[model samples]
Target: MHFSLPDIENMDHRFKVNFINSLSGFKSANLVGSIDKNDQHNLAIISSVFHLGADPALMGFINRPDSVERHTLSNIIETGFFTLNNVTQSMYKQAHQTSARYAKTESEFDETGLIPIFSNTIAAPYVEQSTVRIGLELVEQSQIKYNNTHLVIGKIVEVIVQDNVIQNDGYIDIEQLNTVAVSGLDNYHTTHRLERLAYAKSGVQPKPLII
Candidate 1:
């Protein structure tokens, strides 16, 4: 299982891709929703969405190089707004299908039969079926020199979550909502939390904290 840099680079293209992707372990599965100036809605399944900062409510996700038609990133850039909807166990199939290369004129919502809903807060659409939804405004973007991938950063403007899942400490119980995780490129998995450990203090032994 040991692979050196040269060994990895010489591996089959698809094998290298999967090996590198899976090396990071599980990733958040989110459906990004956006719209163009003409109101052409686009839905895309993205695994790289991550938290940037809590004080500013910032979030970031990597955008593959725009060598091809990337509807989600293009729409977000064009409109300055986007939505992230957690993919649940029930809708993951439809969510994964959004990764397909559809024409810019085609709406993935319509193509995949996923319902799109809107609110007064932002212009981007949200997945009505998702248990947790986040609306964000594009604040910054930077291209990585080595990979040509762009880091898209956004500020969270609105969040829609079921009240029951929100713990008193402000943690959302995603496990209770059945949020699915992604590994490599194609595998979807359900998660079981091992424990909620108390914050570490210099000499204190780790202890489980109840939610």
Candidate 2:
């Protein structure tokens, strides 16, 4: 199980890729939806979305090396808008299939059984079946020097969530919505509610967690 840098580099390509990718633990599974200038819609599954800041409601996601066509990224760059939808237990299979290669004219929504929904404020499409949906406006994009992966940042302009999942403290309960998580490239997992701890303070004993 112990693998040095040299050992890992020399291992089989697939094994090395899987091992390195899985090292990051579980990641948020989201379906990114976008539309081109011609109104061509695209939906793709990604797991690299991360929180940037709360004050501006910023979020970012990483697009893989530019070896192939990136419809979602392209549409976002072209139109300046995109939507991120949570991948729940019921739609994990259809969400994963969004990774398949399809013609530019074909949308994963039409190819798969997923439905596309729209809002008045944003031009991009959203997943109608998602329990939680986020509409974003493109803010910035940076390319990694070491790898060709692109870091795309967006500001949340709109959000749609199912009732009763968001708590009074502004925390979105993932376990309540049965939101799924992803590992490496393919495995999917369901979340369970562990205790939610209170903020740490200097001289006080910790309070009981909200469960």
Q: What TM-score, computed on C-alpha atoms, does each candidate reach?
A: 0.97, 0.95
* Candidate 2 ranges with C-alpha deviation above 4 Å: 66-69, 203-207
Candidate 1 residue-wise lDDT, 25-111, digit = tens: 899999999999999999988899999999999999998875222777888899999999999999999998888888888899998
Candidate 2, residue 2: lDDT? 79
Report how far off residue 7 is in candidate 2 (Å).
0.8
Q: Lowest-scoring 10 consecutive residues by lDDT in candidate 1?
A: 65-74
Q: Write the per-residue lDDT of candidate 2 for residues 35-114, one digit (tens) a residue.
A: 99999999999999999999999999998864223988889999999999999999999999999888889989998899
Indicate which candidate wins on TM-score.
1
| Pairs with steric clashes in candidate 2 | none
For every candidate structure, what is the RMSD over all alpha carbons to the true structure, in angstroms? 1.3, 1.6
Clashing pairs in 1: none
